[model samples]
Target chain A: MASHTNENTELGKLKQKIAGLEKLEQQHKKVEAKLKTVNKQLQASENQLKAYNEQLRESEQKLNQQKEAAEQSREFAESIIDTIRQPLLVLDKNLRVITANQYFYKLFQVSPESTKGNLLYNLGKNQWDIPELKELLKKTLPEFSAVEDFEVEYQFETIGHKIMLLNARELLQKQGKERLILLAIEDVTKSRIYKKELERLNKELEIKAEELQQILYITTHDLRSPLVNIQGFTKEMEASLNDLKKLLEKMQIHPAEEKSLNTIMDEEIPEAIHYITSSTTKMDNLLKGLLSLSRLGRQKLTFRKLDMNRLMQQVLDDFEFEIGKNQVNIEVGNLPDCMGDDLQINQLFSNLIGNSLKFLKPEVPGEIVISGGRVENGCRFVVKDNGIGIPREYQEKIFGLFEKLDPKKPGIGLGMNVVKQVVEKHNGSIEMESELGKGMKFSIFIPD
Target chain B: MKKELKIILAEDDEGHASLIKRNLKRAGLMNEIIHFKDGQETLDFLFQGKKDKDEIKNVASLLLLDIKMPRVDGIDVLRKVKQDEFLKKMPVVMITTTDDPREIDKCHELGCSNYITKPIDYDKFVAAIRQLGLFLLIVEVPDLNNMI
Candidate 1:
């Protein structure tokens, strides 16, 4: 019985040893699978970190490019402002000049080498002193756009104490804390002098116009009586005489009278007689026309719708005598109409047509065409004539008084002047277009 | 063309009228000459709304006119004569010292036959009157019965 019990105990001990070895093998396999999974996750996270680092580096490069472009644009703008050949200066918040162009130095008659570290008031170019200019700049900076011809005036002995127009504005930036003022100066001495001269000339012209009017009246009053007496004596001699021999004998007794009579038959007497009548007639007409012009200036215009073709036809009728004499072929083109004056406008057409007839070259066929069109706020009428063309340099001067291009034509050179005055009275403009052989086209614009 | 010829002169100035009549007589034309001093008497004899037979017998052939005269102007007489059908054919000459071409042109346009501006000197005045005598030869002066 003792031998059987000892065998069972040995078998139990052997089974326990086998079970312990199997548990040890299973634990070793579980640890190896976890170690493989952890190694794969670590490799994925390291690859993602490398890509993120590259994205960060690219963003930094783009920021560097943007900063460089902005800096280059600022430098370019500053250099462009500096390149101008006028006196230019930039000041900081302290009222001291931060920078100045070479022109500023030259205009002030101060050397840039000497003025580099100096204040703005130290330079001779300043009209308003630095303190006043700074105050003006501060007040004007916000509303400078509303002001035109704004200037700061002061006297400077170094630049001969002339007037100046000063312009100033401040430059603002988001990143910069300090503001800069840019000042520009223009010398207006010549313009001021020119304005004074123009005023003086206008006053002189007014006096001259009055004097001419007085002289004209005096001349007409003095010339009328003598002309009437001359007509009376001529009629007496022709009557109660019949013999050629007696006439010749009587002529022989008065040698000087014969010479004078011969001259009267030739040129001077005929011309003098014609001129005297014409001068008297012109003065009367001028007085009447001038009164009309002045009246028109003061009164408001009454505008009416007009037919350009009908108006032109009426103008053509007033020219019947001239047309018959010259045998001219007048043409008309597409005519347009708008709201404007009728009577004064009629005078305008008459003057133009008369001028066309008067300026015609002798023995040459005459041609005149009227063209008209509608435009914005106005309409245009053109009288194109193939009579004689004006010189290019003289075309602009034709509208002024006493500017006669042709002396052979009889006029006081007042017709075109009257036309111009009338046209301007209508708030319009007139332009002359011509080439040497092509003749002239005078365009008239009358506002609606 | 030869008939009993007569000329009547009416002038305010005696010197101009006498010299004029003398120059005409010296031109070798034989005509009965009568002189008057003003337009009133001349117009009365020619017109005055009366047509007497004996008074018409002394009617002259040519009428010399001046624009400026007392009582009635010469232009007024010329106008009346021109409007009168029986007297319209008579040649009227306007004589003056003014060299106003406009007035001359106006006179011509008004149907005056001829015009002459007088010479300033006396001798030239005679010469001018004599030359006008030659012009009268060219222009026809109709008889009173034939004119009507």
Candidate 2:
């Protein structure tokens, strides 16, 4: 019985111990379930953190793209400002230059350091301190939103006098939050000088025209009065000789005396009268030349389209007799039409061609060529003659009034003078090229 | 009183005056001629300033005036003479070497009786003087002293 109770106690104890272990095991499972719940919560928090990290990275990428775009736009705006041709400047409201373009640096002959951030009127050795510029920027531009074509005339040491047209615009800078002045400068000195020169030339031309009228008056009246008297006295002397001749014819005379009277009347007296007549004729021709030249000054020019080819043909035809006598070969080349007075041009060509025909060498056949074409802002005509060329000593004087190369010739020596006058009337120029015993070439340039 | 009409030739040039006198003789104009060297002398001879002023004033006369003269021009003399009522009807003829149309028109505007340009051609000049001679023979002269 004692052995059996002992066994039973031992079994109870063991059973109790086993029950405690089971309890411990159940408690451990509950603790493990709670731990699983906590681990799931931790995983959920980590996923949320990863999503937050991705969002932060995307926002940072977007920020970088915006920054790049802003930089590119800024660069493009600066390039646009640089492309303007005129000198451009950006200044603060205080008239301090904030920035200047490359043209501004070049035009003012200054570096960016000297120009930028410097007072606009105190730059480049105070060359920019012009009262007009100061007045415009400080007073005029501030009063107005924009100043256009405000002229500032200043003298620069390097560039001499300069006329600058300033254009200014008042602008509000959006980013910097400041008032800016946009200044543009244009140089117009060349055009201003051209206008001044043109006015001066016009005044000179008016004075010259007045003087020409005075010359015409003196040449016509004062010079011709004495010539008329000489002509009248010669006629009186001839009448007296006729009466003396009749008286001598009625008287009976010795042979020797008759011979003496006949010689005196026929040879000596007739020779003397011939010289006087010829001299008077020459003087009369010279006076007529002067009159014609004077008349040219008063004549109103009638401008018309003139066909040079047809005119040359007509001029050549008019000289057919002379040409035939001289056996001259004339070549007419391509010629351009010109605007001129027909009568004066006809007279000019007549004199020129007549001179060519007159000066032809006796030993050789004459070659006369009339040729020309359009040139720079004008037409050029060349009259080349293979004839006796003018001497170098007489070349300059040939165009003078009453200048004669050959006194024995019948011409009054006014042909070249009239030619020069006519050329001047047409606003053209004639230049002679010659070498003695070689040839003569006259080139005429007439402006369109 | 039958006073002969005289011709008064006012010329600065002596040769022109001689030519006129000789040509007038050739054309049978036998009138006595009085010559003046300049415009001032011509003015003095007329308007009763010269020694023979009374004789010249009593006679019927014609005045031939040159446009160009020393001291005073022919236009000034014409202006002075035409301004005076007594000398206005003196029948002045303008003789000049200048055939400028402006000068000719100016002389005609000044009441010149005739305008004659001294011709450079010998035959034409003599013919022009002869035409003047023929005109002198026919034109009637008013007696100034009788009218006064």
Candidate 3:
């Protein structure tokens, strides 16, 4: 029994060894499969890595070429800007000169070598040494977008004197900072001096304007009071005379029958009445015109396009009674239109025509003709009267206040004055041509 | 038919005032003459729907008004009067040097009785006064008691 057991144990050991061999074989196969799969993946990864490396090399080459192109463009643009005739400066973020025009180098009295790539403040030149300029530039940094045109006068140890304007602006940005700045310098010393002179003149003009205003006020006020008194007294005296004459008429007992009454009425009564009436009328007109002038001086004038046809018709209507009484003939031709104040222009017409009727030639019968038409950029108006024409000396004088051509004719000198003031107010000019015996003609040109 | 004479005088200039008064007197106008200076003063004297003041009770025969005056102008005064019940009847004669046609039209629109541009001739003016004075003599003076 012991020999059989020993033999079985040995067989068992052999069997176990067989099993172990089988297990080893299976493990080897599994490991071989894993190695095959891993080798295949490794080959694929190697191919991908080679392709990626090639692409990266191409990208790097393109990047290098782009960088080179950018650098070349920057240099070319800088050279182009620096070639300008005007003094120009290109500064980088650090206020260092990236490029400067030839004119700038000459103007600043700085050598090109020293100015290149140097900080502007450190140039050791008149403009660079200026403390004010430095302070202004430093304070105005980055946000400094205003175009300064003020004159800057620089005097230095080396250069005699120079005047310039510093005009600068932020040109470009890069890397979250100002990349470039452009500055232009212009010389305006003479113009600055001229502006200062202009300022001085403006001050003088203001003073003169004030003086004129005060004078006008004083004159209007003083003259108005006296003129009022004169007008009052004249009317009172005339009225008293009229009352006496009327009293004589009512009584009908004083030697004047029909013929006698006719003689008195025609000769003495009419003559006296004419004197008193004309004188008072003239004075009244003067005062009223003066008042109007004063009002004009005091108020702001409003002007607009005035239809001449409408304005003249109305003015002529006002003269209906006077025209009828004087037996005067007025023929109005085609009137030109213009922009003007209605009231003032109407006054102008009335005064001119009224003047014509007043200065009548003896026994010739008064007649007036108004004619005009449009011309280039304006309209022309002519007033021709068949009355005693004005003398050359009196023509100019006629426009003056209280100036009259004929003292014998009862009129205040205000008629022509009104005409002139109104015409000028309308932005027009007036010219008068007259013969002492024939008549007077006035031409007025008003711009449209 | 003769209309009653009642007159209003609006004048700011002292000389204008006296001249007007004297001429009215020579015209032998016994009708009441109510006078005021500035336009505002004249307006104040006439407006606010109040009954005519005792001096203006006759309804004013004629208005001899000047256009340029301190405070308010004659044009303003005339405008106010024409808009009123009693004062509009009075003939408003613009007796100033300004013969502005617009002023005449405005006066006419506002119911002015007439507009007379003050002429520079003293004698002619007296004659104008004489004519108006003759009208006054012919016109019956409105009795204040009978006026509305």
Candidate 4:
């Protein structure tokens, strides 16, 4: 019985041992599954961390590019402000200068250190604080969003007197940002002075012309009284000489003495009287010409549309006797109409035609051509004559008073002067082209 | 019988007055000519009678007035004479050196009977004086005292 009890005890011991071993194996498998779950959670956490790091690096690179672009734009704006030629200023809402262009600093004679960030009125010891400027900036600019050509005349300390035309623009900002103003300055002092000088010269010229006219009128009128007396007294002396001659003829005297007396009456005394008479007549004609010339300034001009063809025909008809005598051939071309005084224009053409007739070359049959057409601003008429032309030396003096080209000619040197006066009165211009012994041409332009 | 008509000549220049008197005599005008040196003298003779001259109450007279005189002018004399009751009927002729048409028109507008421009040429001046003499012979002279 002892042996049987010992065997059962040993088998029961082995079974218990085997059962413990199986339970241990199951616990080990459960530990391995927990480790696998922990490994999966660690892999998920590593992926999320990598994604956050990549996002942070990308954001840093974008921020650097944006900063570079902002810096470039700011530089571009600065370059634009500096490049303008006119003095330019950028001001804040308080009218304090934010920045100034290089031109502004140079023209105002102010350094950038003293100019920038200072109130515009306070700059240069308050020299820019002008009433007109204050009115424009304070009152005019706010109502008008933009101000153009706001003139301010101020006495500056450095520049003396300055006339500035200010143009301002309000640069509006969004989101309640500080508003700025763009001020552009133009200096018009030199141009204004030049204009004033020109006006003064014009007035002085007008006064001089009026004074000349007055002098001419007074001189011509005062000379006539003495001329009349000289002519009348000359006639009286001639009558007295004639009476003395008759008395000597009736009385008997010594032959030699009578011969000398007759010679005195016939040759010397009569010759002197004849000279006096002719000289007086010539002086009378000259005085008459001067008087008429002075009167031309006061004559009323009646402007009318003139038929140039008819007028030219009338002028030719007036010269018909001379034309026939001179054997001149006149060609009348198509003449354009123009507005002018009738009597003055008639005188102009008459004088020209007469001059042509007088200066005709004897060797050749004289040829005169009158042609006209509409020019750019007026009517242009050409009077071309194949006649004795003026010498180049005398050409410049032909329009002056009492300038006669040909001494042998019968005129008193007043014809050409009258022609010039008539042309000036009509506000017309005349140009002459001539070569000695070749031909003469007159081109006249009269406004339509 | 008509009283002999007396001619009153008003001139400023001595030479012009002598020449005019000679020319008028040559024109066969034998009428007595009374000369005055200036417009003032002529006015005094007509308005306030001269101390040495007879009273001009019944005198039949004609006036030849020259313009451009000292103290007073011919136009003033003409205006005053034309305004007067007795002197207005007396024929007045304007003789002047000025040939300006405006002065001639002004003389006519001021009631001068005739206007004549003195020619500088001696023959023309004699012819003008002769024409004036002939006109004076034909024109009827009004007595100053008889006119209203």
Candidate 5:
């Protein structure tokens, strides 16, 4: 019986050992499934990590490109500021120069390094330290919204004294956190001097016009009274001669004396009367011409829009009879419209064109061209004629009142003077170019 | 029958007055004409201190006035004559060398019978005055004898 118990105990111990080994195998299988799951999760994590690193690299490249574009835009803005021609400067609220344009440096004759970061008044050995500018920066800048046209006449070391118009405005920067001043300077010395000179010349011209008016008034009244007396007595002399001749005829003189008296009455007396009448007529005509010339200054002018083409045609038609008799060819080109007195312009053109027809070579047909062209500050009218031109020496003298080049040409010599008066009254200029036997050209310039 | 009228001529210029008298004679108006050298002399002859003076007191007369006279002008003479009840009946002819339209209008504004512009040409002047001389014979005028 003792031997049987011992064998049972051994069998139990052996079964227990086998059961423990089975438990160890189940634990090992559970651990292997967990390890498989952990390995799959780790592989997924590695793929996600690679994707995250690639996204970070793309973001960095975009940031670098945006930085470069912002840098390029800043350079473009700076270049645009440098291109301004006027002397422009930017200053901080304390009046220290922040930035300046290229013109500022060149105008002040200072380098950019010397200009920037320096006080505006202290720049260039304190040349800009003017009282007006000091008043502007000290009081006007803070009170007014802007400082405009503050004139500062300052003398510089390099350039002479200059009149500058300084304009300034307060500008806000960085969302109103900081304030800046934008100042612009312009030089107007030359224009100011020119305006003063023009005013002086205008005063002189007014005085000259007044003096001419006084002279004209005296000539019109004082010179005409004696002429009238001489004209009236001439008629009386003719009447007296007629009565004497009748009385002598009735007296019954001798044949020899009668023949002598007939010669005196018929030839000598008539010839003397003819010469006197002709001379008086010429004197009367000259006086009348002067009267009319002076009257032009006092006459009221009616200004209206006139078509030069139509006016030329009308003037040409008025002279149609003379033109046909002389076989003169008149051509009119495109003419500009102008504002002027119709009567005066008509007279002007008639005198010029009539001279063209009258002064033509005896056998040659006259040709005249009336045209208008553009000038620099105004319009130009050209009257060209292929006729007997005036001599060069007489060109200027022809404009004088009663100045006749050819005494036998049947003109009172006042036409050219009238033309000059009309042109000068309209503030225009006339130039004549001609040779003795060649063609003549009259160029007139009138402002728009 | 209408009595002949006397002519009162006031002229400042001697030559102009002589030419006018010759032309009036040539036109064949047979009337007595008195001449005054200046405007003051003319006013005295027409309206002397005594209103009734010999030939001019009772007879009807035509006044030929020249403008631009010394001391008193034709316009002033016309004003004075028209204001007088007795002399207003007398016909007045204003003759002058002034051809200004304003002066002609002014003369018409005054009670003048005719405004004649003396022509600068001798022939035209003679013709103008001859027309006036012929007009004097035909036109009826108020008598100064009946005005009082």
Candidate 6:
């Protein structure tokens, strides 16, 4: 019986051992399943970390590109500011210079080390500290946001007296940042001096012209008085001689004495009277010419818009007889209208045409051409004639009073002078070109 | 009754005075002529009584004045004579070398009876004097002595 009970216990223990083995196996299986789940979770977290690292690298590259572009833009603006020609300055709200352009440093004879960050009034040893500049900057600039052509005349020890025009603008920064002022300077001293010099010269010219008129009046009047005396006395002597001859004829005279007296009355005395009369007449004509010249200054000028073609026609008509006699060929071209005095212009044309007619080369068929056209600020007229042109030596003297190319010519030698005077009165200019014995040409410019 | 007319000639130039006298004589003017070399002498003789033996008072006189004289000019003499009560009745003629229109107008404005520019030509001068001589013959003279 004991042996059979021990066998039963052994069998039970074996069975229990087997059950424990099985449970342990199941727990190992459960642990293996948990390991699989944990592995999947870890794999998902690794993929998420790799994605975040890629995103961070892209963001860093984008930031670097933006930084390089900002640097390039700053350099571009700085280069543009340096290239400006005019003296330019950038100042802070406190009126201290923040920066200056190349032109400003060069013009002010200063360097960036000494100019930048310095107060505008203290720069160049306080040379720029002017009262007008202070007014413009402190008072005018605040009211007007921008000031243009604020003139400041200052004397610098190094640069001498300078007339400057200052233009300033308030540069308001974005987002209510600090404000800056942009100032530009211009120099106008040389041009102002030129204008003053021109005015002084014009005044001197007017005074000289007035003095010349006075001299001409005195010379003509004083010379005419003596001329009248010579003329009167000559007539008296002629009358006395005639009376003596009549008295002698009535008396009985010796033959030899009568012959001598007849010679004196007929030849010597008459010759003397003829010479005296001719000389007096010549003197009278010269005095008349001088008087007329003096009177021209006192005469009033009446300006009119003149048709050049019609005026030229009237002048030619006055010389119709001479033209027909000489058989001179005249060609009238297109003429532009101009503004001048009618009577004076008429006289000018008459004198020019008359001169051409008077001096024509007798051998050639005389050809005269008159033409005109519009020019800058005026009209230009050309009067060309095939005539006995003046010699080179005598050309310069033609416009002077009483100057004659040929002394034997009939006129009093006042024609050219009169022409010049009329042209000057109209604010016109005249030019003459000629070759001796070839032709003569006159080019006149009269304002419209 | 008409009083005999006398001529008073005031001229600064001796040659001009001689020529005028000869021309007047040729024009058949036989009146008694009195000559003064300058405007001052003429003013003295006319305003103040003459002390010379040939001085005649209370005569009907005609004045021929030349401008541009020494001392007092002819314009002053004309102004003085025209202002006087008795001398204002006498005829005054201005004969001058100045033909300026302004001077001619001034002379007429000063109450001169006639203004003549002395022509430089001898023939024109003689003809002008002859015309004056004929005008003098027809003009009725007022005697200064009869006034007041």
Top-DockQ structure, candidate number? 2
For residue A444, what is the lDDT in candidate 4?
Answer: 93
- For model 6, residues A174-287, the per-residue Cα lDDT tens digits are 987987899888777777788899899999987888778768766775666665667778888888898988998899999979888888899998898888877767776676
Specify the highest-TM-score model's number.
4
The candidate 6 chain A region of ten consecutive residues with least summed lDDT is: A220-229
DockQ of each: 0.02, 0.46, 0.18, 0.31, 0.16, 0.30
For candidate 1, give the docking quality class from DockQ: incorrect
Using lDDT as the measure, name the better of candidate 1 and candidate 4: 4
Q: Estimate each model's TM-score.
A: 0.43, 0.56, 0.49, 0.64, 0.49, 0.56
Give per-residue CA lDDT, model 5, range A1-448, as digits (tens).
7778989989899999999999999999999999999999998898899899898899899989989998999888778878877888898888899999888888788898988899988998888778888788778998984899988887887788898899999885678476788999887888888999999999999888877865874564345444444555666677788999999878979998888889988889878866766665566566556656765675567778778889989899999999998888888889988767786788788888887877888767789999996677667888999988988788889889779888887768998899899888778889999999997888887665
Off by over 4 Å in 6: A1-95, A98-114, A139-186, A250-260, A300-410, A415-448, B1-120, B125-148
Clashing pairs counted in every model = 18, 0, 34, 0, 0, 0
Residue A116 shift from truth in candidate 5, angstroms: 22
- B-chain TM-score, every candidate? 0.85, 0.92, 0.75, 0.92, 0.93, 0.91
Against the true structure, candidate 2 reaches a TM-score of 0.56
Candidate closer to the true structure by DockQ (higher is better), 5 or 6: 6
Give iRMSD, candidate 5: 3.1
Q: Model 5 misses residue A403 by how many Å?
A: 3.5
Fraction of native Cα-Cα interface contacts (under 8 Å, chains A and B) also present in model 5: 0.07
Candidate 1 global CA lDDT score: 0.69
lDDT of 1 by residue, A344-398 (tens): 6877888899988887766579998888888888898889888778779888788
Model 6, position A60: C-alpha lDDT score: 84
Clashing residue pairs, candidate 6?
none
Off by over 4 Å in 3: A1-94, A97-182, A185-307, A317-329, A336-338, A351-368, A385-424, A429-441, B1-148
C-alpha lDDT (0 to 100) for residue A148 of candidate 1: 31
Query: Per-residue lDDT of A1-448 in model 3, one digit per residue for the tens?
Result: 8989999999999999999999999999999999999999999999999999999999999999999999999889778767765788878767798878878877667877888799887886524767766655666745565457645687755665667788877775657775677778876666777899999999998778766755664564445455445544655555666676777767756554757765775587667655755554555555565656655544445677888988999989998998899888889887767777777777788888887877777688788999989988888999899887866776678788777666666655667877887787778899999988889898888877
